[model samples]
Target: MAIRIKGYKWEFNLIESPEINAWCMPGGKVAVYTGILKITKDDAGLATVMGHEIAHAIAQHSAERASQMTVAQVGGGLAGAAVGNKSESTQAIVNQLYGIGAQGLYVLPNSRKQELEADKMGLSFMAMAGYNPQNAVGFWQRMAAASEGAQKPPVFLSTHPTDESRIAQNPRDLPEAMKYYKK
Candidate 1:
């Protein structure tokens, strides 16, 4: 059956892996790693993750990220030239500064925003698809617990929102998402 989200054709792939991860590529291609099923626990939890991934595609997050990276690269080059074109130390500093600045100023924040948007969109999608939107909060909480003690970059340098932040927003978003729930 054709899905409610229109325009692009959707394809799902199941991959065997031990890493708890999933992703949606541009043009509605999606992949779910077997390892994530542990956290998903049930069909509702699975719907939560699936909706989130699909929402990323619906929002065109991949294209926006690529465009942002291109801009950041060009801006970094210009900033480097402005600082110093000659000294090796200056070049190194510029590179480091660019990495910090790009991530902190643009990339990380944009990524977090996209994540939140996807969460909101996903909540609605799952609710409309006959899954309880409230389950999303529990799913994220489980995901957070699963990743505890694992090495992770600091929030400023990371792309996705921190688990605490993601889970915290769910209750706030639940009311709206519930409106779309059919059963």
Candidate 2:
């Protein structure tokens, strides 16, 4: 099936990995690991995953993230330089503050927004493609459960939305997404 994300001539690869991961790279390269299929369990579930990944590419999220990181790094460097005349302990404190402030004020929030955007757009895409968008909720719930015992960075430091946040928003978004469904 041709995914209709603009500016992307999609190509897909099935990698033989046990990792439950999938990604869409710049220029429309997509890869899915076999392991995630175990969780997906059905065509609609798979569509949920594929649609989300494709949405990332369609939104040019990677480029935006890189740009944000570059800006943060430059700003951090400038802040560090301005504090160079301070004592060593003061310099360390400034560095830590910069790291935390940049992450909280820009990076993590942007990432969470991107994830939410992808969720919304992916649901619409799947609905347009005749997949049931409601399945997304179940798929995400399963994904969350799967990660329950795994160690993850705190939400403020992580790039993706916590599973709980993602799941919580699905019901609210599903009604809008279903508007795109043909049947």
Task: Return the top candidate by lDDT.
Answer: 1
Candidate 1 residue pairs in clash (backbone atoms < 3 Å): none
Going through the candidates in order, what is the number of backbone clashes in each?
A: 0, 0
TM-score of 1: 0.92
* Best model per TM-score: 1
- Candidate 1 has its poorest 10 consecutive residues by lDDT at 1-10
Q: Which stretches of candidate 1 lie over 4 Å from their true place?
A: 1-7
lDDT of 1: 0.92
Query: Candidate 2: RMSD over Cα atoms?
Result: 2.8
